[model samples]
Target: MSTSNEPVSFPAGLEGVYVCNTTLSEVEGLEGRLIFNGFNAIDLAETRTFEEVWFVLREGRLPSQSELSTFVSQVEALSHLTLDEYKLVKKLRGGEPMSAFRSSLSAVANGRGFKSWMNRDKAVVAEEIMTLCALTPEIMEVLHTGRKPKLKAGNRGYADRYLWGILGKQPAEADLRALETYLILTVDHGLNASTFSSRVTVSTGADVGAALTAAVGTLSGPLHGGAPGPVLDMFDSIASVANVSNWVAEKMAAGHLFMGFGHRVYRTDDPRSLCLKRVAERQASPRIELAKAAEAEILAALAAKQQAKALAQNVPVRTLRVNVEFWTAVVLEHVGIPRTLFSSTFCASRMIGWGEHIREQIAGNKLYRPRSYYTGSKP
Candidate 1:
């Protein structure tokens, strides 16, 4: 650890920093690709269920038919909230939705009886993982409606349960597939901000509940999981596609974020965004056409700005493109997820990722104590 903050060199925002190695997932930024356990994420999203992908992610192998059935049944059986856990969520009402969701995680994480992260054997952690995965959607229901989630018997899959619980109605299979793709695609993506936070918290021997709640807290930031709702809202403010150029120009000139445009990595298009674009178009999402139109104008505006900057400064320009949040807003809205619940809904998928990382961190634990060089003068 460094005694000083800097005069030290590092990537601004730790942009390309590599922390720990894992057999979990990888993000190929330049190619705009995401891979989970050596499987192309898009392929998994298209062909495999979220449960299957999750099994592969945690075990490093795809499940057999019997194994998958067992996993699904276990998840379904564990989905029910106990009387006390149900009561905990009732107190979570009336805050930022994601904040309430983060608190709701404690209903399992801290409220449920589990030893510290170090003491729990792998079986207990595995159970915690399954329990949290199944429990999240039900908690979201309670958090949102201030009542138990209206879940039905024999849900088609994990996505069906979550969508049915949150929306309080049976979702169509096609809509469930769309939501499944979104969930599987987003379940994990390399060492993202929230995933890293989960690993860090668990590395310190905290329980899964504590670590996941921490992850959700990190995800609640506008810079992370909070952008999707605003992406839909951005379209509402634009009068028409013809007006998009002017709107983009005004926002850029004002030093405002373009809502759903651009990513920290991924110089090319974002793969998840592309998948959701296709899903939105196929679903005939009300916002898809406008999102496409606005995306074009935003890209052109960015190019013009970058070209001017290049001519003036002769420095290499980094490109920014559409990120997952753009079409995620559209498709999730098309599937009946409220704009406000967009970020919380993200937790439904990501809790699995957080659990996986937390388990990994605890297995070969190392305290995450990174160093920084101090820049301030000594007294």
Candidate 2:
């Protein structure tokens, strides 16, 4: 151990670090498992609504029927923007969707103006966070259109409300189920980049708005939340099953990373991808066949590339496989979500997670101030 003031060193990007404990979710990379608050996330995606999973993540257990009803009602009550907030989205309409969402949400959450959420009760802060999560789709709607879009019916749930608002029509029930599944599967995934950013922000006693805003900005980074749209673009470029191999070969020869073919965490098929594949199948999307074919070609290409090269036994090969973005692109596109709004839609679900973690951060309250390795000219 360095007895002096030299900072402790860690792997760049802090890979394999365990920073804190949480009851929110566990991502088992080796097993390709994702558990949310002790429930299997795949099962939740199959059987739950946006409201139910949001409840489970924040409340740490499945709600009783009456409890779920109460929670749904509560979310519904919170699912509105003030008139001024509605007007705010009009001004932000032509801007980038995620940027618009971040700014507008921060504005709404700090309506009383920039008070530290640390001063409030944990329950109140959690409530405010929930209010923001609930309000997000409404804000997204007005951002898409330069006017306040109408809701489908009273408290239709997050996916329903969002699908209708964006498409301006009631989507098929199956489609609604598909989008909800995507939202549930993605709501939390341990201390991912954006979630970590949120916790760090709130750990410093920032307002909940500021914490969530920081998370949105972090998520906007392509390495974090910008794969789905490009995944769709790749499939469109491939055009047909027969084109997949040559297309993949050309791209790989040019040193392009396959957008949806691997993951940083999962060595096997991403469980979220598996779930979304099912959703895409159920939707009968025209794009899924091309995506699957392209994925197979890409995987074979990756494996062949690895086998052709010499490697040490200790070397970790890319686990060439489909990830969540592979089918996320298919399902979201089939469900009528615009390509430009892909990341924004991701943020909508992830809002649940950021809220849950930000609350957890403030409840225990430790500021995040990591020391850096000094490799520059000695001071």
Candidate 3:
């Protein structure tokens, strides 16, 4: 190595950067493992309800039967949006679903008196969390259907309520289970872009609403939480298995991204993709079939053209595999969710993680401050 009088360079996009330490979750990209509060996320994805996982992430352990019953009751009690909140949601309808969700959630959280939760005890903060969890799906329901969410006074887990409340009908057993698995898988994943946004906002002593609002805005960007719907769009355009090769080739030649095929962190297959693929298979919807066929065709085409070095300098591109968004779109479509509500659906589940992370950040209590390299002229 040659020495030079120059500033040292860091990884772009903060890849492999450790911003802060936490007990929230760990993303082992190479190993394709995710651990949440010491529980294997894949195990929780298969065996636990969203409420159960929420309790684990927030309280550091899974809930007992009594604890789960009480927790479900509390979450249901907090799920209903007041009349004023509904009216506010109405005013914000007809915008992009994620955009509407962000504004409407901020309005609902502030209207419910956010200051009461700010700087309060964990229970109060948890109430604020439960409020967001309860309301996010409601907001998505109204935004998608232009109707008030159907509130039911009965025992239901958070994921089940979201499905039934949004559709205004009891979801099918298979559909409900599919959605439950989706919610559990997405509840948390290390410090993603949106979670970091929340942690940063909360670190500066902001309320949960402010922190979550920051998260929602960050999540709205296409680079972060906006790929699921487009994956469905890609499926629509491809339309059949026969067209997959030509479609992949044309898009690849034109330098267009295959919406659901890549991820930032996973060098190996995204384990969530594997979990969701099984759900998609069990659901057995036409869209899932199309997505699966397209995924296989794309992979085969990539492998065949590996010697050509089509997209990268490496002999093969590991990112040319299916990611969580591909199967997420398949499963969400299988469950009858509207495409427009995809990212909001993501937020509905991810809000649990956001709330838990904000609480953890506040408990640790340090402001985030990072230095930047300056390349412009300085006075």
Candidate 4:
């Protein structure tokens, strides 16, 4: 009984809808700002652990000492994968590491106990966070190295323990801290494309696992959250300080968008990138000098080339100023994680925010079926 001629009112630009709202996070896309539980993302990136950030996103506040201990214990307890789960991850490979990770997560969630565990309200959020944080290393290990990794038990920071368990070796404390900061910075960012996709899936009554899986798929697109690796690759190709300007100019001449140069939001510098750059500087890897030089040259070239480019200063440049991507690449590289794993790591961290948004959508009980104005075949 659907009428093709019925005057279907649309929102023109997909503007107003209470599709989802999360108290844990908000993004002012116009201003390029990200906040988590009333705290600026930069503050969390500088001062908090990944677990602390996760606690804030799920429970609405940074955890106290005792709460942090309890949360860490819970997370550590859920870090291990069963024999069958490990086997399954080992079986799913030969493509993009992020894609493999997403597929593994989906398959593991379909295992018998996963559904029951995910459905429990008292521990659902914490459980989901643990699964995401833990499974990432497992999936990465299986895909990149083609080996089953042994779980390590000890008193290490979450990021340290994660990299250690995956790579089967202890990471330097500085590297672990840098990775932790990266995770904290990336944890949540308003209702971004991927987060919205997660909310949409959850609105259909899908469990947290399915919603997170959907979010990962959305993030795999280059336009969304898939640029970090390419950013590093660009830096590598530029190679030295002197070639930076020429390299950028050449890429622009060829009609290629510079990866990690400008952001869709943020008229000013990205605050998160600023904080990350600080971490990168402190880490002080060899690539730091090269990265900084390239960044400076790129900015100079951008300013000279186009007034409207907005590329003279942005998050990526700020990150390069601090050598953020270089340091991240260095640390991750040292830990045996391939460049391809960067996006997967991003997805792993952002899953916390996605889950929070999904819960918000379910609570609001609204379907996000936005209508569009008819612009085709009206016969």
TM-score of structure candidate 1? 0.95
Question: What tens-digit string does per-residue lDDT give for candidate 4 at 1-379?
Answer: 3457555765543455445556877656546577888888778887888888878877778899999998888777766667888788889987887788889888877772345222357356546645765666656666666777655656465677656655568877777777788878778876677988887777666666788788889999877776667777887788887787778788767867666666554555666666766665776766677777766766666555555443655423332122234345554554456677777777767866776676666556666675554546766
**Per-residue lDDT of 220-271 in model 2, one digit per residue for the tens?**
8899979999998888788888888789889989978888777888888789
TM-score of each: 0.95, 0.95, 0.92, 0.84
Per-residue lDDT over 1-379 for candidate 3, one digit per residue giving the tens place of the 0 to 100 score: 2254355587887778988888989988888888999999999999988888988997789999999989878777777777878888988988677788889888987897786344578778867877887777667777776787776555357777778767778888789989999999988999899999999998887778889999999999989878889999999899888888889898767867678876777877889999999988887788766787788877776655654664667545444567799999999988888888888889898998998888788778788998765555646
Off by over 4 Å in 1: 1-6, 375-379
Q: Where does candidate 1 clash, by residue pair?
A: 4-373, 4-374, 5-373, 5-374, 6-373, 109-209
Which residue pairs collide in model 3, if any? none
Q: Count the backbone clashes (under 3 Å) in each candidate.
A: 6, 0, 0, 0
Assess each prediction's global lDDT (C-alpha) against the native: 0.86, 0.85, 0.82, 0.69
Candidate 4: TM-score? 0.84
Could you tell me which 10 consecutive residues in candidate 1 have the lowest summed lDDT?
1-10
List residue ranges in candidate 4 displaced over 4 A: 1-18, 28-33, 113-133, 155-157, 308-336
What lDDT would candidate 3 get against the real structure?
0.82
Candidate 1 lDDT over residue span 108-227, tens digit each: 667678556676577888788678878888888888888877748778878888898878889988899999999999999889999999999888887777888899999989888889
Please give the lDDT score at residue 342 for candidate 2: 93
Which candidate number maximizes lDDT? 1
